[model samples]
Target: MDIAFFTDRRNDLGESPVWDARRGWLWWVDIRLNRILAADALGVVQREWTYSQPVGSIGLAMGGKVLVAAFADHFALIADDGHAQPIVAPDIGEGAIRFNDGKADRQGRFLSGTMQHGGQAEALAGVWRLERGGSATRLETGMKLANSICFSPCGHWLYLSDTLEGVIRRYAYDPETGALGPREAFFDCNTIGAAPDGATVDSEGRLWAALVTRQQIGCISPEGELLRTIDLPVPFPACPAFGGADMATLYVTTIADSGHKLKSDHPDAGRMLAITGLGARGIAEAIYHT
Candidate 1:
């Protein structure tokens, strides 16, 4: 697959590339910049929303709104005007915990997880499930960095990754009950000397994971075998999502190298990228019903 630059705009911490099929737009967040950006498939900025605090991730909600996981454990329903209606306030007590990567499940429940700021190991952050009426349930705990929270195309498995642990685990999913069974080791990023970041499942049940330090996306089979690797121009590719009308266009977001030397070496580190002609189709993102 040939990789191409999608946008010149750089993000300090670009993560969570979400395809809004209803609006035909791609949405993502710059966690360090505290901003959410929406752009067309051609990389034209259509709308931008700035927040007072870091905005970790976003998922499409019912009635044309968005479910936002804001910094410091704030989850809200945000309108186009950037007005956020409080949904749930999870109390993650002290020590630099914030929402990181999240999305909606097939059953329309919003699922999000948290991580320790500055990559320090404090308490184990947790993954949460938000119901329609604004009630939050802790799904999984004991994770230092929770990421790559996505489900299989059939919603039969839930994938979760701990970047610090350098492993991705899979759990049997109950779509009707919104429950996750015992987790089994799915993939080991340590094998490639990389940390697994954000990820998505393609229509064929293949898992595409961003190997942050390796500057590539690793495609793996459901049985945890490495299938292929897509090299990236940037050093820290944070996340990937399948977009475009046919859902074959793979969109990637990267992190900006903060140091002057690294930034000078990789100027395009934080830019968005698109991989085309891969012939891989993606399932529609599940919508948050609440």
Candidate 2:
């Protein structure tokens, strides 16, 4: 696997890479900076936007004109001009929890998870589903450091994780009603000595998960088997998404080692990487509707 730099800037907590094939741009967030950025295929930042709150993750909306983002406190629609349009404010597990990693399902419903700063020892973290019309609903509870949110290509399954437990659970998803069935164990990162951070499913239904602390990306099959791992030089790869001219390149977001749970010094920790020769194609990210 050949990994190359995608951008010159370092992100404290870079995540949620989304590719817009129609526009030939890549979008992602720098959580610590509360910034969202869009870059060209060559990694030149063409446009940048900032927000008042930490941007946990972003889902494209209005054909990439607006971004559906999970701000630390609430969900909002952010425009190219940096104007934030308020959306439904769901309960953020009281004051201790703030919204984190989010993804839009095939049907365009946005789902986000709330997590405690340290962990879920407080037992207040939860997953939420937000509809296009500003209606939000609780999907799952009893979580900690939720991440790795992605759905099956057919929209019948959803994979989410509570990073503290190093496990990603699969649930039977209701695409029509935005309902989730009981969750069952899907993939465990314990085997790799890491925790699941973020993930995305490819067009072939294979799940590519960023295994934080392990310095690698793990690919799993639809049957929940760890197929293989792509090693990285950095210590904490926070998120992974497939994008590029052919949608075969894997773009990864990373966390700075200086800011990791077990902080250390690593020069390349916060930089983003574009990996090639993965031999996988990705589905276009589902944009948030309305």
Ten residues in sequence with the least summed lDDT for candidate 1 = 257-266
- Model 1 has an lDDT value of 0.84
Error of 2 at 219 (Å): 0.5
lDDT of residue 180 for candidate 2? 82
Candidate 1 residue lDDT tens string, 78-106: 88887778787887646677888987888
Question: Relative to the true structure, how large is the alpha-carbon lDDT of every model?
Answer: 0.84, 0.85
> How large is the C-alpha RMSD of every model relative to the true structure?
2.0, 1.6
Cα TM-score per model:
0.95, 0.96
Residues 29-115 of candidate 2 have per-residue lDDT tens digits of 988788899899999998788777788888988854578988887888887787888787876656656888989999998998877
Q: Model 2: residues >4 Å from true position, as ranges?
A: 118-120, 257-262
Identify the leading candidate in terms of lDDT. 2
Number of clashing residue pairs in every model?
Answer: 0, 0
